[model samples]
Target: MTQDAPRRPGRRQAMALGAGLLTAGALPARAIPAADVQPPRYALERGARLRVLRPAKFIDPDEAIFNENTKRFTDRTGIEVRVDYVNWPDMPVQVAVAYNTGQGADVVIGFGADPHLYADKVADMTDLAEYLGAKYGGWFDLAQVYGKKFRTNQWLGLPMGGTTSPVVYRRSWVKEAGFDRIPNDLGQFLELCRGLKRIGRPCGFALSHAPGDAPAYANWLLWSHGASLTDEEGKVTLDTPQTARALDYARAMQETMVAGTMSWNGASNNRAFVAGEIGLTQNGVSIYYSAKTSSDPAQNAVAADTEHAEMPYGAATKAPETALTLNAMVPRYTRVPNAAKEYLRFMMEAEQYDRWLTGCLGYWSQPLKSYAESAVWSSDPKLAVYKDAMDTPFYEGYRGPISAAAGAVLENWVVVDMFARVATGQQRPADSMREAQRAAQRWYRG
Candidate 1:
C-alpha cells in the first residue's frame, strides 16, 4: 500500500516495508486522568477540521478503530477530522516536505526520535502535557526526553503511546535447543543461535541500511553490552572499548546468522522466520499475528509454534529494542490549536485509549505507568512478555538527547553499516568502530 514509502518501523509498525505512502498515521510526557488536568477553558470550535497523517493501523485488522474513534471525536465535538495514511519509509521525507511547504496535517504521528527534528515546526503542548501527567501519572524518562524540548523542557508534543518490539521466534525450536524459555542471558542467546545454526536453522538479524531494523538491532546489542551511541553529556562514545566489544559480539553473531543478513530489510527477518528459514529474530508481535492470520494451516501451525521474548539482557542492559515511541505533534502552521489539543486530550482518557489499544491488538503497549498493570497483558500468555519490555524501554538516542544530529545518524544507518562491515568481513571490529566513530563525530560536530 505504501507505493510512496514503506519505511521500516517502527523498527513504523515495527514491521518494516518500503514501497509507497498511504496517508496513515507515542507516549507523551504522560497519559490518563480526564479529571486530573482542567481541559483548557476555550470551548471546542465548531466545524474545526484537522488532517492527521500516520502509518496504517498495522496492528488492527483495519483502520476501523481509528475511523470509529474519529467519528466519535467528531460527534463529541463537531470538529471534522480528515485522516490520511502514509507508508513509514515515506513518512520522514513526506512529513518534512509538508512542514517545509507549510502544508501539513494539524496533528501527526511522529516516530521515536522525531520531535527534536520538528520541535520548532510543531506547537508546544506544555499545558496539555502537564495536565495529563498530573492527572494520570508522571512521565517515563524516555517519554520525557523524547517528547519535550530537549534543552527547554517546553512541551512540543503530546505523549501518545508507542509500539513494543520483541524477539519473536519458534517455541519448539528453542525448546529443542535445551532451553525451556527464550534465552534471557546474552551468552545463552548466542549459543542458542549456534545450536540453531548447526541444525541448519540459523538466526537472522538485519545488517542492511534499514531505518527501523538497523537501529533496533544496534541499540539493543550496544545497550546489552553496557555501551551507548553517545554519553549523557551528548558526546559520541561509539568508539570505546565497550563498543568494540559489542562489535566483536556482532561479528560472532554473524557466524551463526544467515550470511545474507547483511542485506536484509525490516521484513527480511520476519519473512525468513515465517518461511522456516530462520529460528530467531527481533520484531514487534505483528510477525506472530501474521502467522496466526494466514489462510494456510501450515502457516497457522507455524503460528502455533511462534512465540515472543524481550531481548536478552546484558551487563549494560538498560532498555529494550527501540520500541516505537509514537508521539503526536501539532505543526506550528496549524489553524486550530484548541481542536488539536482537545483531540489529543480526548485520546488520553482511559476508555478511548484502552479501547484503541485493544483494537491495535497487542502491537501497542501503554506508556503510562498506571496502565502497566492492565489486564490486556494479564489476559494472554503471548502478550505478557511485552509488558516488562514496554515498561523499561529507552528511547533511540539513549544517554543522549533526541536531536537533529542523532536523528541524522540513525536515518543514515551508520550504526548498522558499522556492524555490517564487521559481520560481512569488510573490516576488522576495530576498524568498523573507527569508521562509525568518524561518521558519528561528523554528525555530532555539526
Candidate 2:
C-alpha cells in the first residue's frame, strides 16, 4: 500500500503540499493514449427502472445532483435511475431490511462502514474495481480496504468515493482572537480554543450521538494521538497511553468549548456555526454550503469568511486523519448488476464525478487519485484544503482489516461514547478508556 511509503506526505509535509498545490486545481488535465477500458454495459432485457437508496450528503444535495446527472445517463442509455435519499444514520438499517426481505436498493450508499458488513450480499465488482482502479491511477487505501473483504481480494462494490472530515473554521474569528493562522498541532489547537473562547466565539466538536460528526471527531483525535480501534490482529487495542493522552486533550478542549455540545447530534455543530454560535468544528464543507446558500446576510458573511484546514496533528507525525467511504453496492438479488456497475462507472468518469463533488461543494472526496486534477479545488481556495483529505484518511478499522466487528463497534458508538464520557465528565479519562476497552473487547470477541 502507498500508505506506508515514505513518499506519501506526512502531517506537516502534507500541509505544505496542500498549501503549495492549493493551485493544483488550476493545472490542466493531460490524458496520454492508454489501453481501452470497455465501459460496463447491459442489455435491454433487464428493467429500465433502477431504484437506488442513498443517505443524504452535505445537507442532502447529492440526491438532486445525482438525479440531475442521470438525466444525461438516461438520455444516452435509456435507463431510468431513481436515487432515494434517506437520513444518514438510517441508511444502513433501511438497506439491510430491504435487502434481507428480497427487495433491494439496486445501489446502496455504504456509509458507517456498510460495505464490509454486507459484502456477501452485494455483487462482486473485482473486475470493475480493477478497471476503474487502473483507469484512475489507483484507489485510495481506505477505498480498497472498505469495499473489499477482510482477507480475500473479493470486492463487494465500487469504491465510489469518500468524505474528508477537516477542521472547518471561521477565519475572521481566528484573527479576531489574535491568531493569523489556524492551529497546526494539538497544543496550538488548545490555545486557539482558549482564544476563541476569549473572543466569545467558542468552538466545539459535537459530543452527542451525532451519526457522523461526533464519531468523526472522536476518531480524528484518537488516530492523531496514535490510538486506534484495534491492533493489527483485529483485537481491541484502544486502552493505551496514546488513547488516554487523546482523552486528556479532548477534556481540555471541552473546557474551552460551548456548553451544549454534549447533547448535540451530527447537524448540531453545522447549525451552531451557521447561527454564528461557534468559531470552529470538525466537519466536511457542508457548513460552507449551508452558509453560502442561506438568504440571511449574516449567514452569507460567515460563509464568506469560512475556511478549511487540516486537523491539528499530535506530537507524532504519523497521525492518519479519518474519512467516510461511500461504496456503491448492488444487491445480489438485483438483475441489473451491469446497470448498477454502469452507473458507478458513469459517476467516476472525469466529467461526471467532477461535477458531483463540485455540486456537493467538496463534501465528498474522490476515491480515484486522478479526480484530484479537477479544477473545483482551485476554483475557490476554501475547497482546496479538502483536496488532500480523502487522499490521506485512515479507515474506521485502523491497523486491521475492515470487518463486521469493526462496523459493530462503530455502529454501537464505542469510540464516540468513549470521548463523550471524557468530555462530559462522566468518567475520568483513564476510567473511560478502561470501560471503553472492555466494551470494545466484547465486539472484538464476537
Candidate 3:
C-alpha cells in the first residue's frame, strides 16, 4: 500500500546530475513538407528550456535519430532542450524520484502504467494525444488503454512506443531439436524447452527481479493460461484453478531452463544467447541487433543463426500480453509546460517520427497505427514479427483498469515472485497462488 511520498516543490530547481546528457544546440533544420504537418499553437514562456529523461538506447540509431530530432526541434523553435538517457530498468525509479522531488526532467519517457501511478502530478495530455491520433490514423487500442486516465478521457501520458519482446531463438538449434518453429501450445512449448535442454543449450527466461525480462514472461505466463491478478472489477483474484495450472506449467518449464536463470537479470538472456549459451529466450530485437552489428566475427556468426517468433498462447487462445511499453508525461511541476508539450508534439510528427521509427530497426513498435507502414518492418523479414507489438494486449493490469494499485503490484514484482517461487520449487502451485493473492489484495483493497 506504500507509495512514493509526494514532496511537491512550489518552485522548480535545477537538477545537478549532468552525466549522460545530450545538450541540444542550434543546428540546421531538416526540410519537411509544410502542408503535411500542422502543429497546435503553444505560447512558450520566455527563455523556456526543457529537460527530458528517456531510456538509454539498445542500438545506436535509436539514440542518433532521437538526438538529431531533438536538435531539429531546437532548430525549429528557439527553446533549449537537455536530454538525459538512463538505463531502462532505472526509468521508473528516476521518474518516481523526479515527481516526488520536482527536481528532475520536466518531460519524462517512463514505463507502462507509470502515468496512472502519478496521474495528478502530470499535466493533462488529452489535447496533444487527441491531436496526434487524429493526424495519424489513430492510436492503437492498447495505446489508448495505457494513455488515458482510468474511467476518463483525460490523458495522463502519451504513448511513445513498445518494444516487441518475442522469442529470440537459434534457428539451427531449434531445427536440430526437431521443431520447425516454437509451438503455440503450452505443453509443446515445454517439450521444446526440454529438447533444447537435452542438447545442452537450454532456454532461459528471467526469473529474478528484472524490470523488463521478468515481467515480460511472467505476465505472459499468467495471461496465456487464462489467469490474471485481478478481475474486471479490480478485485484481487489470484488464487484460482487457472492460476495454479499456470504456476505448475511454469515450474515444469523452469526445470528445463539453464542453470542460474533464477538469479539472472534483464541483460542476462541477451548476453547468454549471443554467447551461444541458451538456445531460446524472450527478448526484444536488441540481442539480434547487437549481434549483427558487432565487430567480432563470432558474434556476427551468431547473428546469422538468430531468428524471432511471437510468444506462444495457451488457454487464452490468443497472443499473451507483454510489459514493453514506454510512455511520455510532462510533470505539472515544470515551469514551461507549453514548451514541453511542443517538444513532444514536434518529435511525434511524421517528418521526425518516421525516421526515428525506421532507425530503431523494429526494436520499437509504433503506438500510432499509421507508423505500422514504417520501412523498418519491411526492411528485413526477420523484423516483421515485431511489427504489431503495440497492437497486442499490454499493461500488466489486464482484465481490469490500470490503476495505481496495478502499478504498485507491478512495482513490487509480486507477479514475478509468485511465478519464480513455483518455478524454483520454493513453493507449490497452490502455495504460490495463495501468497500472491494475499500480496495483491493488500494493494487492490488499499
Candidate 4:
C-alpha cells in the first residue's frame, strides 16, 4: 500500500484559512411572534441577537450560504446574528474552552454525534416540535436514524443537511478502461482498479486514518457486507465474521489503490482526484461539486466527466450504507433559545432550504422524505443521481440518546486508528477491527 506524504497543515493553519475565506454579512430581521403567545416563548424580539459557533472551514459550501442566509434573517427580523467559525481540528478544544469560560454560543454546529458529548448544554426540543410540526405539515423524520420513531421532545438537535457516501468516478476514465458501467461488487471494483492501474492511472479512496472520513470508508465496507457497528440493543458489533470478510476484501483492494492515499485526508483526497491522479474513488457528493466548480484549473479534471453512483456492494448484499448526516442544535444556555428555535424553523422553510441546498455545492441531500420525492429534485438532471441513490439508503444503527458522543468517539479516534493501522500494514484487518470494537466498548460504557 502507498503511504501519503504528510502535507496536512497544523490546526492553526487550517483555522487561518477559514478565517480568511469566511465572510460575514449584516444580520437579518427577526420574525414577529404572535400575540397571546408568551413573549419569551416562541420568538425573539425584533432586535435580538444570536451568537452561533461552528467549524470555520467551508467543507460544505452550504455553510457559507447559511452564514449569508443568517444575515438575511437578521435583515428581515431585526435580529443580530454573529457566527464564529472554528476549525474542525480545533472545534472540540474551542467548544470546551468556551463552555468552561461561560462564553459558548447560543447555537453550535458540528457532527450529528456531537450533541451527545454536550447533551447537558443543549436544550430539549420537545416543545418546539409542535410548532415545527404545524408549520412543516407533520413531524420531522428523526426515525431515519434508527428504525423506530424517536421522541421529538427529547431530540435536542435537528438535521441541518443530510449526506451520503457515494462512488464518484471519472466517467471518461472508467469508460476508457473498458468498463461500460460502475462496478456493483467488490471483486469488479478491484478488477476495474487493477485495469486502471495497468494504464498508469490508479483508483483512489479517502481512507485517511482521520476523523470524519475514516469511519466513512469503514461503514462502506461494513454496510456493503450487511454488518453494522451496533446491533438493535446498542452493543458494539464490529467483530463479526461478515465484518472480517469485508475487511479482508478491503485489505486486498488496498494494494490496487493510488500511491499516497494512506496519508491523504478528506481534503487531500479531493485534491488528488481533482488533479487527475486518481481515476475513481468513493466519498461524499460534496467533493464532486467542489471539483466541478474549483477556480484552479488543475483541480477540475473531472468537472464535466464525473458521475455519481451508489456505493459498490459486497458479495452478500446489494444495498449500501445510509448516507452520512450532520445536524444543528440550540444550546440550553443560550439567552435566545426561542430565537434559535425560530432560526431552525426558518432554515426549514422551502425557499430558504432550496438556497441552503444549492449553495452547499451539492454536498447536502434532502432531509425530509417528502422533499426528496418532490418535483424539484426529480426534474433536475444534476440532482437526479442523488435522488436515485436515496431510494434504498440506510442510516447508522443505535441512533438514540447516545448518538452524539458515540458517533464522535467512533469517527474521531477509533476509526482513525483502525485505518492508520490497516493502511500502514501495522495490523491485520481483523485485529484492527477487534481493537476498534474494544475502543467502542470503552466509549459506550463511559
Candidate 5:
C-alpha cells in the first residue's frame, strides 16, 4: 500500500509545492450519437512504449480490470504501455514536473481543471475529442467544459470520468429523523439534521482542509445559496451578501454536526459512518462499496442500511455541484504522442470502457452519455444518484472560466477555509467572507 490517493480530491497548492508554472448542463434523455462519424485511425509507432500517470486505483477491481484492458491493448497493437498509479496529491506535482522537464509519463490522468492549467503545454486533442464524442453519443457538458481550451476551443485533454461526492447516509437513520427522503430545501434539510442530532446521531460534514470532502460540502453550501467566487470575466467577486448568507447557513448547520467535523479529513466521515458514530455525511460511494464487500458482520449490516442521495440546494435551487472531474492529456514533449493518444482511445472504446465502468462498482460516473445504459447504474439502486454526476453544473471555477488562478484558489482551499471558520465559530459570516474575498483576489488578480 504505497499511500494511494483514496479518492481524496481537491488539493494543496500545486504551484507552490511543485515550484512550477502552476497552472453544465444536462438534458436530453437519450445520448446524442453520431450515426456516420468514424473514429479516427492512427498508425502505431514501431516499438513504441508509453507511460501513463494517474491517481492510484481507489478500488481493487478498478486496477484489475484496467490492467487487464491495458494488456488487451498491448496484445492488439504490439506497443507496450506502462500505467503508473500514484496518489491524487502527487498528480499535479508530477504533471508539473513532466511539463517543465519535457520528460516522464507520456500521458497523465489528472483531476479538476488540470487540462486548462497546462493547456498550452499539452498536445492538441481536438480531433480525438471529436471522434470520441461522436462515437460515444457525445461527452457530457461538464466533460466538454474541462476537456477543451476555453478561448481557442482546442481539446486539451480526454474527458475521463470522475468520482462524485454524494450524500451517503443510513436509510434507517434518515427515516428515524422523520424524513423518508432528503429534502431539496436547505431549511428542511437543516431540520432533518437537527432531528438526527436530537437522537444522538448527528450528521457530520467535513470542515477540515480535506482534498475532497471539505470542498464538496463548501461548494454545495455556497453555490446552493447563489454565491460565486468570480464573475464570467474572471474577476474576484467573492465578498457578497449571498456568500455571507451561505456562511450564516453553515454556522446554523454546524450545530447539527458531530463535534469533531472541523478537524475531519477526507476519510474521517467514512470511518465515522461505518462505526455508527455519525448518521449522515457527504462522500463517494466507497463507504458503501467497502461495507457491501466486507467480511465483517457489522459492516455488512451497515451496508444494508446505506443509501445515496444528491446534495440539496439552498435558496438558489441551482443544479448540484460535483467535487472532481478527471481528465487524461498528452504532453507535447512525448516522443510517441500517437501511442499515448491511441492508448487513451483504446481504453475509451465501448468494450473496454464498459468493463472498466462495471468493475469500478459505481465509484466512477461516466463522462460520455452512452455509458448511461451500463448495468452498473441499475445493478444497485443506490448507485443511480452518481450516474448523473456529469449532468450537474460545472463547479471547479464556478461563474468564471476554469483557469490556473481558479485552480490556485481551489488548491489554496479558500472556500473550504471560509466555511470551516464559520462552522467552527472562529469567525463570523461577514468576516469569513471578507477573508475569502482577499484570499481569492490574491490569485485572480495576479
Candidate 6:
C-alpha cells in the first residue's frame, strides 16, 4: 500500500507493536457538552464538503484521526469533509499558486515557520481567538509569540500539534562506548562523539537542507551556546562573539557527522540515523514512530536500542530554550469562520487531543501541559525519557510579531548555501556567517 493509503490496518499493527494499550484510564476527565448544547451556526451541514491539503509523508496517523473525527463531525452535524495529501516539496508552491490565484483548499498544513512569509495569502486567525478562548478555555500560550498571536491575534495560523527538536541516540552504542549516559554538557557531548569516532563509529549530526533541517540545528546550537538570533528589538544580531563560538562548534560537528549528510535533507538524515549508520543526530521525535514501523527491519534497527534526551546544552549555558512549534490557522478566506473556530476548539479537548496524538502515532508533542505531565507520557517507559525534555522547552519570542523578516531569512537558498559552505570547509564560519548575516540584515531592512 502507498504511504497515504488508509492506515486502519497499520494503526492496528502499531497498536500491537508495543504492549501499552489505549486504556480508558488514559482519557482526560473534562466533560464535553451534551448534544443539546447549541452547535455553532456555521457547523457543516449534513454532506457538506471541506477541502484540506497537507504534506504526504507525515500523513499517517494524524490524517487517519482527522478523517475519522471529521466523519464523526459530519455524522453528528451533517457535513462531509474531503482531504488531499500533497508531497512536502509540492505544498509550498501549491499553496503559493492557489493563494495568488484565489484558489486553494479550506485548510493547508506543513508550512512550518514559512507561514509568516505567506501571511498575506493565508487567512489571519486573530478574529477567531475570542471564539476559541470561550470554547477551548483560552488559546495556547505558545501560539502567541511576543504578545501577538500568529493566526488569530496577529491573525496568521492556528496550531494543530506542538513539537520540539530533540537529541536522539542509540543507548546501546553509548553504553558500549563507555559513556554511562547521554551527555548533557557540550564538552562531554563532543568527548562522547570523539570517543565514538575513534572506535570507527562516527556520530551523526543533522546539518542537511538549506533552511529546513540545517537552520533548525543551527538555531538549536545558538541557543545551546546561550546566544539569540534576534534581540528584543527584533534586529538581526546573530553576529555576536557568543554566536560565533556556537557556529564554530557546529562547523566542527559537521565535519564529524556521517558522510554524505551535507547532501541529505531532513528525511535522509533521519533514515541514516535509524539504519544504525550514525551514532546520534538532532531531529524531531516523530522519526521514532517512522523508524519503528518501516517495512525494512534494518531501517528500524535503532528503534529498540535507542533513547531520547533534551537537546544538549553549552558549557556556558546549562539549559537552552527552543520553540514550541505547531501548524495552525484561522483562514481569512474561510467561508464558515465560526465552524472553523469550533473545530479548532474541539481539536484541543482532551478526548479529541488523545485521538489525534495516538492516531499520529506520537509524531509530535501533546499541546496540553497536563497531557505531557500526566501518566500518558510517563507511564509509557519508552516515552518517559522525553518528559524531562519537555519541561523546559523554548519557543520564539512570545511578544513580538512573527518575524516576516526571519521567515524570509529561512527561505533564502543563498543563506542556506553559505551555511553549508562553512560546514563543508569551503569557507570559514565567521566569513560564512557574516555573509548570511548581511543577507538577513538586507531582508530585515527591506
lDDT of 3: 0.80
The segments of candidate 1 whose C-alpha lies over 4 angstroms from its true place after superposition are: 1-37, 42-46, 317-320
Q: Which model is ahead, 1 or 3, in terms of TM-score?
A: 3
What does candidate 4's lDDT look like per residue over 1-446, in tens digits? Answer: 11123334334334422432332111122222222333125747555688887765445444556776787788777878888876555667776666556567877776555665666677776555444434433433432342112333466566655555567778878887779888786778878888877776688765665444556676677777767767766688877887777777677767888888777665666666777888777666555555545555654566677787766776435446454455566776677788888877676665566555544433556555434433335333655666533334345443223454466665556655665577668999878989988987786777
Better of 2 and 5 by lDDT: 5
Tell me how many clashing residue pairs each candidate has.
34, 1, 0, 17, 1, 32
RMSD of each: 5.9, 7.6, 7.7, 7.0, 7.6, 4.3
Error of 1 at 445 (Å): 1.8
Off-target runs (Cα >4 Å) in candidate 3 are 1-38
Q: Is candidate 1 or candidate 6 better by lDDT?
A: 1
Residue 145 in candidate 6 has what lDDT?
Answer: 47
Worst 10 residues of 2 by lDDT: 1-10
User: What is the overall TM-score of model 2 with all chains considered together?
Assistant: 0.89
Q: Could you give candidate 5's per-residue lDDT for residues 327-426 as a string of tens digits?
A: 8999999889889989998898766777777766656688888878776776678888888777766578888888888888987899999988888889
lDDT of the candidates, in the order given? 0.71, 0.74, 0.80, 0.61, 0.79, 0.58
lDDT ranking from best to worst? 3, 5, 2, 1, 4, 6
- Of the two candidates 3 and 4, the one with more favorable lDDT, higher being better, is 3
What lDDT tens digits, residue by residue, belong to model 3 across residues 182-215?
9998889989999999999899998798768888
For model 1, the local distance difference test gives: 0.71
lDDT per residue (tens digit) for residues 307-343 in model 6: 7776677743434534334465444565755555556
Return whichever of 2 and 4 wins on TM-score: 2
Query: What is candidate 5's local distance difference test score?
Result: 0.79
Q: Whose lDDT is higher: candidate 3's or candidate 5's? A: 3
Pairs clashing within candidate 5: 9-211
Candidate 1 residue-wise lDDT at 18: 16
